[model samples]
Target: MDQDDSETCQMCPMDEWPNREKTRCLPKLQEFLSYKEDKMASFFCFLVILCCVITCFTLKKFILYWDTPLVKANNRTLSFTVLVSLLLSFLCVFFFLGRPLDITCMLRQTLFGIFFSLAISSLIAKSMMVCIAFKATKPSSSWKKWTGVTLPYSIVVVCSSVQVLICVSWLSTYPPYQGFDMTTYPGKIIIQCNEGSDIWFYSMLGYLGFLAAVSFVLAFMVRTLPDSYNEAKYITFSMLVFCSVWIAMIPAYLSTRGKYMVAVEIFAILTSCAGILSCIFLPKLYILLIKPYLNTRKHVFSWVRK
Candidate 1:
């Protein structure tokens, strides 16, 4: 008998396996979307990070101009929070890259869900604030008391808190874990995270969608109001873009497998975030920077009158 035939190869850890000759080891199939291997994922990661940094600069600019009448028209604090959450949402795509460890697997989806929920909730709160403001000016309207930061802040907190609870329950019950998918590709092993429950994942998405739908409806209803006093038109367009991206995402997300699935999601995240940022803030930014004259109360009133 050959000496090599009788001796067993050393046991490999979960990430590696014995080579064909049994004298050395090779890395087992790495399933996660890796920046080192996949150029697409790497490109996306860089793009999202760049967008996040730009958003941060915009955030600082927004803060500097906080006292402007245009910024003061709605809840600035909530707006800031939404921008922060969108930044986080963009950054969260990193978790889906590299190898799928247990902790990263668990966090990638949950954090994405949570951060997006916070952003959507903030949008809904802002839309609601607009509605309340319009209502408060009417005769004997009790909504006058609810016209302050209190209601918008509460809406953000309460809506986001519910999503937090949902994620917690999902994690405690069926946490995601690293898994090998051997059957998807012929003669190749695929490494991926097995999301513990599809139901939980979809539920998280559904909740985010629900909040977005509410915001879209409310903002659309108020879109005809004076654009000077209310940002409902911009909000409506932003929500429309946000909803369209995710709605298109669902079928594509369901249809793709392996790394493409993750890519679809990452793309959706960046697109929706960019949509919100551009649709809602770019016009205001243009007014603030390039056409500063238009930001004045006098210009606003005159435009409205015309």
Candidate 2:
């Protein structure tokens, strides 16, 4: 045999076998690529959710801070932090839009990140609020009127800023055209942030999961309180909706494949809609505008919107 043939036989490891490598690595790469594509797609739905989450929590906090008995008399540290963090969260979405990457992708990640921050902030604030509310009526009496929003958004903001910065630096370090793309399928190349492993994505899932869990536990506690406490019920119900929405995301995340994961994001928009409609606004409207119906009850056919 020739010297070249000998070298080829000796150097070829099992993984480097020509056709065999194609069989194993190619399929695995395709699955991963599909996953990446789905991640990108899901980003769209995530943006709408981010808007909803931020708008609901931040605006209501502003209103609540102005006059709610929940934060009766404590330091405004949490309140101010949540407020400022929310503002920054919204700004993050806006500035993220101007990134050179595909606007659609930027929109998705920005929205997702903001939504995440708000979710965390809401959980922290709600848990504290619930605890304070319960404790206020008890022995210590120190928590009277001390309702503070849990400014978890601050940590989320810093973490998200770093994540975005990492992604931006990775993308800008080289022009898109010159980037190394893994060709996973025929005529298809995987475009990923590649800051590291998919840890960022999983971190999101983990954080969101933690927030949802806190919301669920506190909501359970709130519901068990006296029915005379109607305000508690409303907040609890809203939290229930938020928690459920985040919980439902687990399956979508698992089943998603690249570019298709956007469907999961779209789902977020619908959930956010439900959260706003059923949780916060509907209850308040019922209390404010429709409560009069309780005294002079009347019925009418609903009018259809054109």
Candidate 3:
């Protein structure tokens, strides 16, 4: 008996990919930073949670020692702002872990941008406060007026507001949305958020870098101030770390594709935030908890006289 002749195979639809055996068209494997499937995603989740828990613990310690010289000297209000914004920044990482959706796409970058701006704004405010405090020590210094709470709060509000405005414009003009990339990898589709406007995206990041640079400069200027009011040294170092992480992230983020690109950003967020938290708070926490004597006004005054 004669066997039936083979027929030409038809092309699979764009949404579907062919199996290895070419026996049938199968749904494309959706690629994303999946919390359940990807080990990197799970690790990121663990880090985000760990960072957030540490932030909360630090916040508690600050609140408990709110009246101490160390806390007050650092500007408790600004310290609280930094912690809260940092907590929010860590939470923002969650938006990047799962499958990309419209809401997550809109929130991940903008929310992170705004939160980071808030944190940096607080840092700059702290740095400026140190400068003003130092200048006010001089006879007939006009910086006396800026030593009040108004100037620092104003700095935070104004600096953070600029980032908010940029994010608003980005969302209104061209909001990011979930998109798929079928050609990047054969037999798989990359599910990612399309950054609607590269200009706006980079602008948000650029503004963050600018704020960090300004903070670093201001803090460095007063870093040599007496230890009594020398949180500026910590701020300078933290900004240096923050700037370095993002500067390195840009190239790595650009060079990678799909889920790894997202991983790069998530790693940057965690590392930069950790840098700020550790550089700024660890010393204060040590004083508050381990060396209560150093947290006293007497010790501060002694440092001032030196």
Top-TM-score structure, candidate number: 3
How much lDDT does candidate 1 score? 0.82
lDDT string, candidate 2, 1-306, tens digits: 113334444332322223332332222232222323445434543654566575566546445544432232222344444444434443343322212245444344545555445544544554456556666766669887463333434544554455455445534453222122444344334443322324555554455555556655656666555432323455466556656776687688668543334345445545643563445334433443455343121211111110
Model 1 CA lDDT for position 290: 92
lDDT of 3 by residue, 1-306 (tens): 112243767788998987766777888888999878999998998999999999999999999998887888869999999999999999999999999999999999999999999999999999899888877888999989889899999999999999999999999999999999999898889999999999999999999999999999999998998887689999999999999999999999999989999999999999999999999999888878788878778876565565
Ranking by TM-score: 3, 1, 2
How close is every model to the real structure, measured as TM-score? 0.88, 0.50, 0.96
Q: Per-residue lDDT tens digits of candidate 1, residues 1-306? A: 113765654565555566667656566665568878889877997888788887897798789889887776667887898889989998898888887889999999899889988988988888888888778878899999998777788888899888898899889999888888866664346778888998888888888888889888988887777777777788788888888988999999889888888888888888998888888877878888898887776755443454
- Tell me the whole-model lDDT of each prediction, alpha carbons only: 0.82, 0.45, 0.92
Model 2 C-alpha lDDT versus the unseen true structure: 0.45
> Model 2: how far is 64 from its true place, Å?
12
Query: How much does candidate 3 score in TM-score?
Result: 0.96
Poorest lDDT segment (10 consecutive residues) of candidate 3 = 1-10
